[model samples]
Target chain A: MRHLVITIGCEYGAKGNAIGRKIAEDLNIKFYNRDLVDEIIEEVGIPKEIMEKVEEGGTIAGKGAEGDVRGSFSKYADLTDRAIHVQKQIIRKLAEKESCVIIGRSADYILKDTKDIDLLRAFIYAPDEVRIHNIMESHNLSEKDAKILLLEKDKRYHKRHLALTGSNRGDRHNRDILMNSSYLGIEGTAEYLEELIRRKFGSEEE
Target chain B: MRHLVITIGCEYGAKGNAIGRKIAEDLNIKFYNRDLVDEIIEEVGIPKEIMEKVEEGGTIAGKGAEGDVRGSFSKYADLTDRAIHVQKQIIRKLAEKESCVIIGRSADYILKDTKDIDLLRAFIYAPDEVRIHNIMESHNLSEKDAKILLLEKDKRYHKRHLALTGSNRGDRHNRDILMNSSYLGIEGTAEYLEELIRRKFGSEEE
Candidate 1:
């Protein structure tokens, strides 16, 4: 079988990582999510959460709060610029290395022009109510708090995508599929996608 | 089997009607497309193309173009207001009566709150290159004209959808499934969806 790469972009609390991880496990392929981001974050000298904000072009509040606002903003720019470069290289390398499921970080856009690998780009999302409920249960937060948190992170997700790939995160053009998890739940969604990928780009062997 | 309503919203050249019609045929259900719109257009007393413009809140270019612009605009508003009411009523009545696949005219949104029918909402789209290619061959236009026509109609599709649904047509929340036809091609896409719908909401019989 040809090398296949599935890149997933999703809404906050949609369990995108959970879905990707499941597909990867079922297919017995490498799954890249935080480990990929953390590697880039290590280079940027910031935590994963902080990287989302910095990558969205937001200034780090600590050093810039009192003085040298421009300096701090550019400092972020430098970090993000470096991270973006490292991101593409790493994404391409990973896809070349093996068939894998990649979650976010614009893997679809980065690999858009690559000729050899089989690519399945998908976006997973759900209605706000389903997402809010997932967030509340998973994070041990109230419904109201989950709503607030969901909105905050969802914005940065789009901003971060736009920063890296010039295309809107939710744009249909970016994905081969966009699925809502409300009806099927995570396991079902993962199973459905696995079947789809196998049929679309499955191996010759059993 | 319970009555199932699959409402599909799609880009112009995605062959969504073909996909929906195939699913309905396979499932042995009613397929709705231009027939539903033609019914309303007869009442609107305008061509289908003109209705696309008018429903997007653009005034008719005739009957009051010179003397009474407001009159023409309000007349359209009245016609659209009437159309909107009829559109929803007809959509609900058809869905309530039988299992069907309804294409475009914001059928998904119109059926959003309907309680009785089992609804599967999908949005079909493809990359611009693929869509442009499809439109060129199907519409007998040059590549350049097809490109221009594609953009023009795509914008009006979204606008007409928003005017009726109060939600962006591409919003993931509005759909249970969004499939891109570029990868699978129309027949494969229809087959995939038929399998998916059957697995998810299939009848008790074989």
Candidate 2:
């Protein structure tokens, strides 16, 4: 089967992963997110804990632990870089092998040159009120705590995007569509994306 | 009283003039077009023959028989430029005194700096098929003749826009809204414009 890559991008609690999963289910395609984490760990030989920390955007040893001059500092840095490199290779490999939906890791920029790839890049966003409510319900946190966590996660994602792509977090211009999830709610948004994908590829499939 | 500049832009046979007249009536404003020729004869002190020669883009005199050498040797070369400049000043003066809708003098760009001006720039367009039908009904022309006339008019308008504004004719990034008059028809488009103007300024007038 030919491959189609769908990238779901958003800040935390904006339902990027959930949307990607729904699209994959509707299309009957494999979806990859944290599942790639294990493949990355095995390939890079990095410790699972370190991989998880980096994946969640925790600072590496030197940056986080103020002046911890350990002898194995270089080793930790190499492992982190290698793990990232392996994850990117796996993503490319999956795209080559079959149709799949990828949630983040800057998939849009990574596969910019590949042909016959229906690269549907979407930005999912919600107003602050709706986002805060979603976070509270999902995490079972107090309003204040949810707000704090949401803000921090947003910042971390923004920083991660900048670090990975050296550009703004969202590709507003390159994206085929920009969705305000508030307009459609979660399930509606997924259905909308499915329709868009079908419109783009339906004729080709026939 | 404030002057409202209404720019009637279209790709020939697009009913720009008709739409402009309707807008003027809806707001009890004076409309300008070929009727401006009579006004210019009175205001600019130019002879009626000279106005006619330049009415539909006559050339200035001495450029060639095809050109008008009087001003720039192109048909309507002398009159079109004079009309634009005179219309600009008249629009400014009229705006100072009362609200009015000035049509098809590139009024949007001309009145860019005027205060208390609610500039409504509109582009009216009809598909070729619709334009041909309208011309056939209004002018008693054959389909082929009407099509030729429409094409020529479109070209003239395009050249006029470039000459006046250094931009393609009816390219409406400058306009607030673009309406397909084919769908709205003449009266409906006018009513819609009236509703829009009322929505924008109704409460302020109150």
Best candidate per lDDT, number?
1
Model 1 CA deviation exceeding 4 Å by range: A40-53, A58-76, A203-206, B40-53, B58-76, B203-206
lDDT of 1: 0.79
DockQ of each: 0.78, 0.03
iRMS per model, in Å, is: 0.9, 11.7
Q: List the residue pairs that clash in candidate 1.
A: none
Per-residue lDDT of model 1, residues B53-131, tens digit only: 5566433334455567686667766766766676677777778888889988788888888877778999898888888
- Write one digit per residue (lDDT tens) for candidate 1, span A180-206: 987788998999887787678765532
Weakest ten-residue segment in model 1 chain A by summed lDDT:
A57-66
Per-prediction TM-score, please?
0.88, 0.47
TM-score of chain A of 2: 0.82
